[model samples]
Target: MATPGFPPNTLDDEGCPLWISGLADDDPNHSVHVVRGLEPAAALEALGADPRLIQPCELPERKPDGWRASLPAAALGIEPELGDMTLLAGRVGEWTFVYDDAGATFGDVHVLSAAGRIAATSHFSINADASLTYYADGDELAWINVDDLDLETDPAEMPPELRAAFEAAGSVELDYLEPGEPDFDICMRVVSALAGMPWTLDDLRRIPLLVAPSHC
Candidate 1:
């Protein structure tokens, strides 16, 4: 019954991006994908979305459901089933932020990384699974299961930057046997490192994003 950093209210001054963690706290199933050098529209397509269905929209005032309900007439009749995947994306400089309501993973990191680099964070609280991943030059540089600190990729093979990101997160010192949920804080730190800047909840809310339903 414990979700560390739930109801995120404070901003971290030390430059750890905790704002992305708020999406996980708000929904049991969610995925936030960041890709460098891609526009919101292209990022959505890279994630397998149909470009014909893409539309400019504000970030959800609440959850995806609320956002869908608030869509304008142009978006009417474009609804997918409740279980179907829908996503919202925006840009921060050269980085594109895509938030998936379905908690889905991308079909191909190679395609996504082709734009530049990819840094993704996801939490599926239902199955107690969470991941923070990084990819560049079409190669997966790091993939960590935050809940257990499991290395899906070989740790020794990770690039120096990925190693540094782990260190910056203080994940190197994490003792999995500890009693409380530390995944939230640790995951965000790694994301911040890969992203190379801080993003806040206010930024997420205020950003102009694009929305689409993914057929993939």
Candidate 2:
């Protein structure tokens, strides 16, 4: 059942349609296309049900350097919190946007990709009122901290299990820091602690890491 405006068409294995208006293999202008299933009428009906289902419109073409240009901060409209910052990175076909809103005090990291996708995001808060946030993509990672987030602390105070995990993940150095130290470093430490934990993009919302009391 092809929708009224969009005709049904053959789609390839990658979901690309055989014929697409204003779309060419080497055309830098269009990188996304709308494809219908074997049933064109149904696809057309779906398109009419949701106008936002239109194909990707802003995707960039492949770049020779392999890495696409970073998305402009203005695109995300991410306003930095009092002591926080935002970072962006990507290649021609992919991009990542990271927002760090906790200054050095708490880690609040958010990551968004060019396909309007969110890959991974993690946060770390410690007892001394320090925090860190991290976001990672295929090859690049970024982080941020809350103000006065990093202070000195003692590794001897860490729970044995957490201490062991940190050591195993090569983050043992963070075990001994006192309260109020660099939140970014601690955030990395938290990430290391969670290494090999069978994490996925969907699990990010379910996990919380607290390095110290301030974060609680």
In order, candidate lDDTs are 0.57, 0.25
Model 1: per-residue Cα lDDT over 33-136, one tens digit each: 77777788987887888899888775433444533332211233344466666777777776677766566654355566774565555334446566666778
Clashing pairs in 1: none
**TM-score per candidate, in order?**
0.67, 0.22
Model 1 bad stretches (over 4 Å)? 1-27, 63-82, 115-125, 150-158, 167-185
1-216: candidate 2 lDDT, tens digit per residue? 111221233222222222211112221111111111112222222212122322212222222343222111122332223332222111212222122222221222221222232233333332333232332332223332434432233334444433343343232124444443332333333332333221222232233211110111
lDDT of 1: 0.57
Q: What is the C-alpha RMSD of each candidate to the true structure, in Å?
A: 6.2, 20.2
> Best TM-score goes to which candidate?
1
Please, what's the RMSD in Å of model 1? 6.2
The residue-level lDDT of candidate 2 at 211 comes to 12
